[model samples]
Target chain A: MRSVQIPISDETIRSLEVGEPVALSGVMITGRDAAHKWMVDTFIKKTRQPEGDDQQVYAALKPILAGGVIYHCGPVVAGLDTKDYRFVAAGPTTSSREEPYQGDVMRHFNVKGVIGKGGMGPKTLAACQEAPGAYLHAIGGAASLIAQSVKRVLGVHKLDFGVPEAMWVIEVQDFPVVVTMDAHGRSQHAVIEAQSKSALEKLLAA
Target chain B: MQDLTEPILELVRLTSTDLPADVEQALRQAVEREAPGSAARGALETILKNVALSRANSTPICQDTGTPLFYVRHPAGWSTRSLRAQIESAVAQATAHAYLRPNSVDSLSGKNSGNNLGGHYFPTIHFEEVEGEALVIELMLKGGGCENVGAQYSLPHSQLGAGRDLAGVRKVVLDAVHQAQGQGCAPGILGVAIGGDRGSSYYASKEALLRKLDEPNPDESLAALEARLTQEANQLGIGPMGFGGETTVLDAKITHLNRLPASYFVSVSYMCWAYRRRKMVWKDGQVSYS
Candidate 1:
């Protein structure tokens, strides 16, 4: 197992190998479907004009993503009325859904990694290579356990997107994941998909 | 009629936080099947520990608590309107209590309801009047990852030489598992409905998932098909989260409906490893849960 703190250096991220276990700590931000779209449209694509605290949200996230990781999650939180937010269940959402925006987001922000479940497509793998980043695969549906690693909910952005779609900044310790795709262009997900496809064909023939 | 909001709230809480004994047991067995220090075993171990933590702390097992699916079998003369109101009430309360996330979102407006109530169809409720004086409600919290990977196949699919028969059903099901990979949340239980129209096909497929994990279809042919499909799917080696290990599917439950002569459809609904589902019964002024 390897230990990775937030704002991970490119050298450290590049050294990480696919199929290796990792424990991520320090501060990171959560972004899911809506957050990704909003980021691309308002900032990267410049298709949608910045409005309603969009600039402020970006300002908050800019430094965090410069070398830090973005987690694909929409966590269940408590104390919204009081604004003392606490993440109750915060597991990784399926990353493939964000494939359209993930690569662009990484390039725009110089992000070091994307943490999520399942995996992403070739575009994301290419982005990882360009930015010296990686794709860390968290266990899908292991929410309560994963939340235990979250020591604090620093803040949140995009409340109108609902609890699951909102981007949350949090402090974590020892968040577990497997390095499915690495900067060196190796991808465990691609390997597994190919192997499974071959196995399926053989079974059908039998 | 007695108000059922409280019992339903409890049902939502338990279902969200705890895994059914059968599902948990299968996960335990799956863990042992993986090689030591393998990602598959590590994933299952984390899942097992998460269930315990969620149960003890009464937190949601998954951040996406998912849409609530309710199957209601009540006696005649009971008001479905009132029952629905009560269910919605309990669902909102659960959200406030953090047992459920505010999952409902507007399709066009790009807005969230901020409660689980997006519309009438948001928390899907299927009601049937049975010949009994009791009321029974079954709830399943099907997560979005598995739901997104669900699939339906038309009969006489020429690619695999599949035709309108049980053989075709097996082919499509295996195809779905391979396509789903880890995205369907492996060690998944497949709920398959064959022979219904497109809409009912999908509906029945999801409804079939409410069955106990190990329960088999009553029909001899269907039971045998279920067994064969389960084994073959695991053979594809898409273990937990597609990490690749000994187990891919924990169980498969199959059910069929009469189809029009022109149509033969097979719908497969994938349930994630969390497998959050539970039942509540109201009988003779007494309430019990299982």
Candidate 2:
């Protein structure tokens, strides 16, 4: 597995081969359906869109801050009186759930990397190519453990949208992730599914 | 009964937020036994490390936090009192303390459930009476990804065509996984609940998943089927995170009941690589590890 830092370039994006595993360390932004819609509607369609160039937008519900990696995770959170609260379960939800809005989010936000579980669809693959970004698949169901690596809460915003599944700005240190999708439009999830299905058909015929 | 109020509340918080003892052990064991290759192994190792970090840092294990699914095996006399109210109260408290993302939105209007309590949010409790004094509670966190892949089909045994015997059951399962791709976060598990009608089949799948990862199937034929399916599924090279390699499936479980001749229904549920479940037996009005 190769480890790379952020400012994910077009060259790096294009070089990413299908079926290659990569560990990423970089600055990442967080977004989900609501946030994606917000970006697309507000930025793409709107006349004045803020600066978004080569930044990563994690399709995450919650944000973490440590060394500097972004995670595609949505957490279950409960607030105390107003501020103090706890994160119950912090695991990866299926990234495919956001496939419909991911491309637009990436383009609008100028996101370079996406950290999530499962891989995105063809449209997302196309966006990764056009936007010159990457998609990383963090292991699913390992949320509790991932929560530990989060050095600090950093900052938590987006309470009105619901803290756990809403868009939160988080800073993490040395957060871990694997490249399941690259800017070149190659997807590990797609290849494996095809191979496994082919193998199944062969076995069935035999 | 030890005035189960406080203890029940504590258990809810611990199970939902913290990794229980048995679950930790099972997770470590799964990584050791199932994961093969650098990527899968690295992922599993990281997962184990995360578990440790959550314990030390007091963070929830996963963000999904999952909808609480409780399989309660109660003793004969224990049913005299209703435990639903106690459990629900505890769930509410735990959700608050655990900081679980409030996923429950009003189906009709898409409004938040406010307190993780919708039609059956937090703990989806299933009750069964056993011939014993203490109650056995199997607590599992069922994530949405895995839950969505769960499917049910009612078919006559004879309708399974020629290739679809017990072998066909295995084929269909692999196909289901293939169809799901990595959407369910595979390098996962398959639970097949065969026999009975539609509803029972669904319950059976969930129940089968609740069984211990290492435990052998009770029925000899079923156990053999499990072994074969596990091996074959892994051979497909779905790998950890569906990257490709010999670890797509950690295990396959099959549970069947003697069925009526007319129709046989089978249900399949897919679990992500992280299968979160723990069993605690409450006997003699007390809770103990299974």
lDDT of 1 at A22: 95
Docking quality band of candidate 2, CAPRI definitions: medium
Lowest lDDT sum, 10 consecutive residues, model 2 chain B, at B155-164
lDDT of 2 by residue, B1-290 (tens): 44555566555555545555544565566577554556767776776776676667656666666677877777776642467666766666666666344566666765666566777544578888888576767777777887887766555233323243576676666666667666676667788987777777777887898777778888998999898887777767776677666667767888986567776667888876556676676655556654
User: Candidate 2: global Cα-lDDT?
Assistant: 0.65
Error of 1 at A159 (Å): 1.0
User: What are the per-residue Cα lDDT tens digits for candidate 1 across A22-121?
Assistant: 9999999999999999999999999999998999999999999999999999898999999999989999999999999999999999999899999999
iRMS per model, in Å, is: 0.8, 2.7
Q: Estimate each model's TM-score.
A: 0.99, 0.83
Off by over 4 Å in 2: A1-27, A37-71, A77-89, A148-158, B17-37, B55-58, B76-81, B99-101, B120-122, B154-164, B258-262
> Candidate 1 recovers what fraction of true contacts?
0.87
Best candidate (score: TM-score) = 1
Q: What would the per-residue lDDT of candidate 1 be over residues B55-154, giving only the tens digit for each residue?
A: 8998988888898999999999899999999999999999999999998889999788988996779899999999978899999998999999999999
